[model samples]
Target: MQEIKLTDVRYRPKYHIAAKSGWLNDPNGLVYFKGYYHVFFQHYPYDAVWGPMHWGHVRSKDLIHWETLPIALAPDQEDGCFSGSAIEYDGKLFLIYTAHYNLKEDGSKSYQEQNLAVSEDGINFTKYQGNPVIKPPLANNTENFRDPKIWSDGQDFYCIIGGQTLDNRGQVLLYKSHDIYHWTFEKVLATSKVSTVQGTMWECPDYFEINGQKVLVVSPQGIEPDGEFYQNHHENGYFVGQEKEGNFIYPQNSFRELDRGHDFYAAQTLLAPDGRRILIAWLDMWEQKYHEQADGWAGMLSFPREITIEDGAVRMRPIRELGKIRRETLLNESTAQGQYTFSSPCVEVQFKAMQDLAFEFTRGFEKLSISYQNGKFLLEKTGYKQRKITWKMETLDVQILSDASSIEIFIENGPVISERFYGEGDLELKFQSTKDVAVKTYRLEL
Candidate 1:
């Protein structure tokens, strides 16, 4: 494999957390420790394609501007370090990750085990000498268990990992640890036997409580499409319910999609200083076209979002610190149906429709159309994908972040739709409606 330099990636996002010069996936080990936010990701630096994995590190003070640190973990005799979570324990930061090893390199004999690494200063890290704290659940099948998310209730440390059974059904495995080095398997909380909404395998699992509700967030693979749902190759959604008697209780109807987007997956959440549950995910999907790989880099992390549950649904709002990147206001006024141009490709736009309206965003032949009518919102792009949602509010608010090669749209602080657009040249915004609409646009600093 030939090496590609970072300078070659023309589509590298300015404000997004991207690999310095290679393929990146799955935002792992997200935590806030000692007044700074740290993020580790699945990285391969030899080329702009997936290879033996390493843990890439970055830190941010305000969640807006980030500084890249060194590679935290690299594969030894094992295959690679896969996705996992981070927890701060007794003034030290501990990372719990999946060790994917293949004995023959062809995966004929492969195993995924849970391991640990610790850091005192949050910069340098050392692998635990007594590693592989948790072995695979099944001795005969070792390929399905991975992605350990750890948290605590102040008495004991708890971790829930995503896995699959021998019959090919997704399950979340629970474990307890008194010390960071030792762990014992407790039980299986939920499985495909409990609900068919769970697919053949669950990749990343996260459990948290908000608004008096316990939410199980997981990325399930091998789900067949139903109507407009699960139309993507895979799904990243949540099940809203409660925990009882060392088990989870979720009705099949309670499962809901988290983000209706084209390029969002492997989401991981962190509890912030102010007690907010914030999330960040890989902004690109697995099967999506990677035109930028030819330029060097391949993926980036989505902007940090704050999550809340309302009316049995999960809602996500962009973190307030993102305002720090607003450099200048480009547009702020009522406008009728017409075409307009913003100052730059990198911008933030907010819109509120006085009445039903349709807004179109375009660059060259690529276009993204958003509209509201008869209490429904729709997002469509030609020859790509479409998403629809029901909205009962009198006024519909839409917030959008447009970069050189990507766009993220937030619908009234709840459901979001993100996509990657490789169109070259300036952006054009147009509206088609009889009623007036208020629009605010800002130029981003980076």
Candidate 2:
């Protein structure tokens, strides 16, 4: 048998973070320690599919170029080291995660408990001697508790763990820790207990504040499809409101989907020192087929996006640091309206359209048709269904970043739609519109 190299994987992304050879999922334990940005993910190294989990490590001085590190946590006395978050305490990096243990009673079901690991050098880590710091509370009877997202307020650490209620409703459990070892359950922060809400299990819950508004992002399972929303098997969305006495005020009226894309879930966000709430998510949805598993790897992370609240809704756009990845200018002009072809999968395109226009990007059979007609913005791909979005604004300005097998479109600094495509050889992009659109294209070095 022969081992597969990364260069042979045609669908592997160039700028996105991916496991070198196996499966990668939910962006986990995202934090900035010392000087570099560390991104840990849910990884299974044995195969290109999900299995006994381990935390795969990678660090980047800049978010564009990444260097792989050793596997951070392996299943020592548990079935897996599931999703969690990281923080820097006393000049040492600490990881708080859910350790899943299978009970030999009938060898059927497993329970979840919160555990801790510490590292001084950020490269080597050891499980804390006092393991299973927090077990499942008596109120919640299910075994679906996991994904602890932690943050601090100058002194004590606050964490949120996704769980299910006794009635099977999706719930977010809040906890407080003084030293990252001892934890006390605070209360249920939020729940999908409404008659209209249908989510059963909440996974990868992220809580943060942006522009004075508190935001809650969660990947909820069993949300039925509603029009163009919740079409995926599971959905990741957020609720924007103000926190009043440990409760969320629904200023936006209801929960809204964060990204209207086919391959986004289990997203996590961390507040940078520079006062930016940046986010990254699992770029492949579980409902979608992973065509690249045959090539020896399965998933990749979405490009880091900055989250903001505007007009009473949560908006996301690519970080400005992504401009550093531009190596050469390919197209730049107000009237730059022609068909451009490229051989590489890494490219960045910026363009503004007025009234009616369409940008058709084709790589063999996979076509990404982006168009704006009569105040309506649309994104269509070959395999997935189209997404039509409408805003109060008249003009549409789009910035697109493309990697080996995925594309992310940012519209007017707000709505971002991401999708996946598989093809070989060259990529062709054709611009056609009723109005002369200003366009700029660059080739990314990463």
Candidate 3:
């Protein structure tokens, strides 16, 4: 290996495409426009850390091969382009983002206003003449207003804006538009005061229908710990509900956390042209430790998932097509009702660890769980403090869930946790350790 120097922040010498030189967070606008997948993100191109935000671009006929384009947006047009949503209207792709105009001296207190942009070629976007289409509500109760997630319902366009109250409570504001522009205030669907010290402000709000049920996804910031709620970034997940005439009725008293791992957050969904509900999440935990930020790019999006309801919870895992990238089968086998072991990353396997070994397995580590039977204990690691996070992570992601093709875990070998990092092979599942040990491995051949 040779030491490479000076350029922009990039994802090593491999093929993982990142936007520009700086920080890239939530996937802003992800839609299958025309026949290609147009994925936009929240990017900051000048540095490795977060600063002025812009909308980055990438398009792929197939999700695997991506072509990076010029920055779709920059603070040059606005002070700070906060996160928002994008949609296609009348054969044109339109973006609705939060333009944060900070006026500390003017005493406006850094408020966010919604702005619009239109793109005909799906590449170059033009700002709307009537910029800042909608200003923040005049109500004295709101604060930190931003993140407009707009979607279409029949012929009408509906949007949900994330915001906070003067008292620091999180709320999502709803609006209705008969014609893309001229949005009318609908109502405040829900209000959640996350914690004692932390004020909750909704980040990104999304509404969709799943299996005859309505689901509401939200990103809430400034949250305090209250048992299950406010877990990751105060939490980014959805609720399965019923909506009639625009009002949502969530009989379920709580929200579900999409990914149990430390990496996935700020998830946004899209109904692909085929009508399948697919989702993508920001695979970077907010304020997380054990991160290798020095590697330049800090965040990556989760593998696409097919969202579904299971036992009143929103269950998400990698979509089936994602596994097609499995160029070679490194390991493959079925164990004869037995106990097994796999405490590593580079290696792969295709057999269960057994009831006793799996800790009473129910589908082998679905996002987040704790089930270890007999002697084989399985824990899905979500990063902890002090000692190497890999030690704990190996107990779950590697030790338990590595048997499936729905996951593609990126590894940085460490001599400290040799049990998890085998080598840099990018190997596929080769053999299955039934009553014995069988494994396979693979690498993303760019």
Candidate 4:
């Protein structure tokens, strides 16, 4: 296969972090250190498909523009370096991740364990000599344990790893460590019964707190569609509750999707310096046809979003630093309703409407239609089922960030939808409404 230049690859994102020439997934080891925000991802550099994973590194002073760094971790005795988290301790950065090893060709026999790596300068990393620090617990399935999320509560460090029981029930295993090395099993933080909506295997678990409520976010596999929710091959959602006596307590029916989109999974969050929980997820889903694979690259990361608990629900808004890339205003109107065309594929659209409204975005042979009527929001795209959500509010406010091949639609007080589309050349946006709607569009220059 011929190597494609990064500048010439079709559908390559301008503002999003994507693999230069291979496969990428699962935002891993997100941390702020030494005046820069570091992002590490699961990457396979040899092909545009899943393989032995390595940690790909990039850093930015502001989250808008990123500079690629050297590959951080590669497979050594282990088969791959899987997803995990990072923490700044004792003036150095420490990464705790899962190491995967396959014992058979068919992968029916495999094992996963937690490992540690330390970096003095936040760029070059050295794996701990005494690796495989924490093995799979006694009652959990070894092959299904991975994606460790580690954090501290000012004293003892806590780590939560995604796992499944031997009986095929999804769960999260908790561990406690005073130092960064030796760890002890704490307890099963949470678990879900084997069902269509809650699958058997849980991956990439993240635990955090907001407004006195603890949130457990996980990606469950083998989810069968439940109406408009759990409609993807895999599902990423969260449960809000309280942690007491090492157990997470929440309503049994409290599971809600983090993003209602066709292509979103393995979300991870970073606690910013100013006390903001920011998140970024893999912008593509499992088993979906990746059109960019033909160009020798496969996946990208969603734009960083600020997470806040509002009205008993988690809300995600694009990071404010993203405004640094705004260049020219394409359209700005107090009361507008009509069709508009723009040559730039990368742009931002914002609007508010009181009455029923419809929007259509078209480019070349691809089109995406969105409508809000009678308190129900509907999204229709080519080659996929329509996604519908109910909005309890009277007014609708939407913000859309469209790049070369990806679109992230954020509805105020509602769920977000992130989708990928393929096309080339000029883009057109049409707005239809019975009454006046305030609209604005800006060209996002990366």
Candidate 5:
């Protein structure tokens, strides 16, 4: 089919890489096997929006550069392989996915099953004969048992799958296994309700430990559109708290939104081969109602972020390695314009509007900034041309400055904008009489 990619865009952002075409949802399987980072996602290959589902795959040695691979898993004579995770064992890569085959009489075409597939080369995957390793324990009505994320504790393996009860409450089903093929149902660990914020099913629930604490990340669908809260088609973020065995600390902190900006969901995390908890999220939504679908493409991948718990909550900072995307360096000089350039040349420049000012930047400037407005900080961009999208300073405070790749705007306090741009032309600074400001630009090389 046609591929919906950013091939036409002159510059792709640092960590976000999307498929050429069609719809993309949750990040399927993220794992480090054979020293290469492999990622899979829920994809509809035929169009820019949702169609028949398949697991789209890609890999990277470093998070910045990536190479696309063939589709990993697909629907068979029975059903389609849905969202799940992957792991490595005894030199073999194992993928666990939700297999859906209609079991209802006349088989009304509704069935949700958990299946397994194994791969040694990390490219080809073969389903086990002992498949459908674990069936839904709650009888014929529970059509929601799916998206299993399995892990280990040095001994036996454990898995958490997203599901809903007959009452339609969102929940995570717990299962345990010694061998990867057979999984036994454990008790329900943490159960969320459908009214637990107006969602039908919770998809792609991921649990892992960061440093010393535990993190439970989930994607809840059907949230009523609330400006910054339920911004996505289906929202995927996390709950930071303590989990003792199967239970979690109640009233989980205010369910923090993953990335504050548009284009992020169904995020899956994998402990990198380097011991860092790296993440990748589906750049599209589940609702099939995005404005960008008309552009001949649907979904993308959010910028890969290094997630860490700071101040009792999940605070993400783009990996430092993303700096490698810096194309070429310019304007690494100091200038005192008006009366407030500064006493010293710092890497980060902050400008405030004391009086209306007109600032001028040199032509060699690769990236320029005019942050610190009124009482807040902003990640802004303005070149000599007519292309600019600045983050409102009131919503965002901290951001990164990369040469030509793009600028990341942190809105609603954190994790918002990843507007990609190709700033290869000349750069200039103009502070209108109404907006006085001092500007700083950090140019890069390589």
Candidate 6:
């Protein structure tokens, strides 16, 4: 690949967390430690395409502005360092990740084992001397084990690792640890056998609690398409349920997709000091062409979102800290319905529609449309898959965050659609509605 400067990247995001260069995927090792919010990701720095994995590091005092750090973990003894989580234990930040190795040339067989790394100041890290802290569980044929999400209940530390049975059924394994090193297998928390839509392999598993309710999130593979759902090669979703004596108990039909978008996967969360559950996820999908690869970078992360449970369903909203990036208000609660222009591509548009409404964002000939009619929300752009959601409410509240190359659409009390687009020059926004719609627009600066 020819060397290219990231500053010239046309589709690079302004506020989202993307690698300075090269390839980036799954957000890993998310934790709040030492007064900084740390985010680690699976990266390959040499090129835009995926290669041997390394842990790329970034830190922020707040979730909006981030500072890139050095590479945390590389493929030293293992073929690659896969996804995992982080925790602050004993005044040190601990990273529990999977060391992946390929046993066969055809990629038919592989080995995965959990390892540990420690950081004293939450910047530089050192791998544990006695690595491979946890191996595959011996209870069943679980060779496809990886992505450990760890947490503490104020007592023993608990972990949930994604795995698949020998029969190719996706499952999550539970484990417990007291000292953060040694761990013992507890049980199989849940499996694909409970529901037909559950995929064959689970890649990432996250377990947390909100408002006295337990939620299990995972990235599952091999799920077939169902109408407008499961169109992506993989899916990220969660199950709301209860835990009983180390086992997760949820209804078979309780699983719901976390984000209804064309490019969303591998979501992880961190508990903020202010008692908020904030989440971030990869803004790219598998088997999709990434336009930014030509500019020496590939993937980015979604903006930090606060997760909450309302009406027995998970609701996600952009964090309040995002307000710090607002530069100037272009339109404040305006009811006009005509062409609005912005000098830069980074902007935010909020609106409330009581009737059918349509909004189009254009840059030259390229256009992206967001419309709501007859209780349906639709997002469409050229050369991209269409995302639609069924909404039952009479009034619709919408939030649109646009960066240089990405757009995140948040529907109040509904689903969110995040996607990537390639456009240049200034932005032209046109709004159309039968009745007056209250709109607010702001210019966002990084």
Structural similarity to truth (TM-score) of each candidate: 0.95, 0.95, 0.78, 0.97, 0.76, 0.96
Candidate 4: minimum summed lDDT over ten consecutive residues — where? 1-10
Model 6 segments beyond 4 Å from truth?
1-7, 104-108, 194-196
lDDT of 2 by residue, 250-299 (tens): 64327788888788899999878798889999988995788888888889
Q: How close is candidate 5 to the true structure, as a TM-score?
A: 0.76
Write the residue-wise lDDT of candidate 1 on 399-433 in tens digits.
Answer: 98888778898888446887876666678998866
Candidate 1: list runs displaced more than 4 Å.
Answer: 1-3, 7-9, 103-108, 139-142, 193-196, 385-393
CA lDDT, candidate 1, residue 156: 94
As a whole number from 0 to 100, the lDDT of residue 195 in candidate 5 is 40
Best by TM-score: 4
Worst 10 residues of 3 by lDDT: 413-422
lDDT of candidates 1 onward, in order: 0.84, 0.85, 0.60, 0.88, 0.64, 0.88
lDDT of 3 by residue, 1-446 (tens): 12122353322323233554457788888887878888788887665567778888888776666788878877765778888888999999999999987777767676788999889888999888898787899894464788898899778998888878777777778888999988988998766634333336767788887778778887766655564334445567666778777677665346555554445667788878777787777756666541224544445565566677665667664555645455465445444333333332222233333232232222222222233334332345323321212121232223222322123332211010110111222222222222433323442343
TM-score of 2: 0.95
lDDT value, candidate 4, whole model: 0.88
- Name the candidate, 1 or 5, with the larger lDDT value: 1
Cα misplacement distance, residue 355 of candidate 5 (Å): 16
Cα lDDT tens digits, model 4, 1-446, are 34334435668899999877788999999999999999999999888888899999999999988999988999989899999999999999999999998888675778899999999999999999998889888765646899999999888898999998777778899999998799999888888855565778889999898988888999988777877678888999998888778689978767789998888999999999999999999999999998888778889999999999987789999999988999988888856478988887899999898858899899877799889899888989988988888776688899999999999999888879999977888889999788888899999987
Model 3, position 21: C-alpha lDDT score: 47
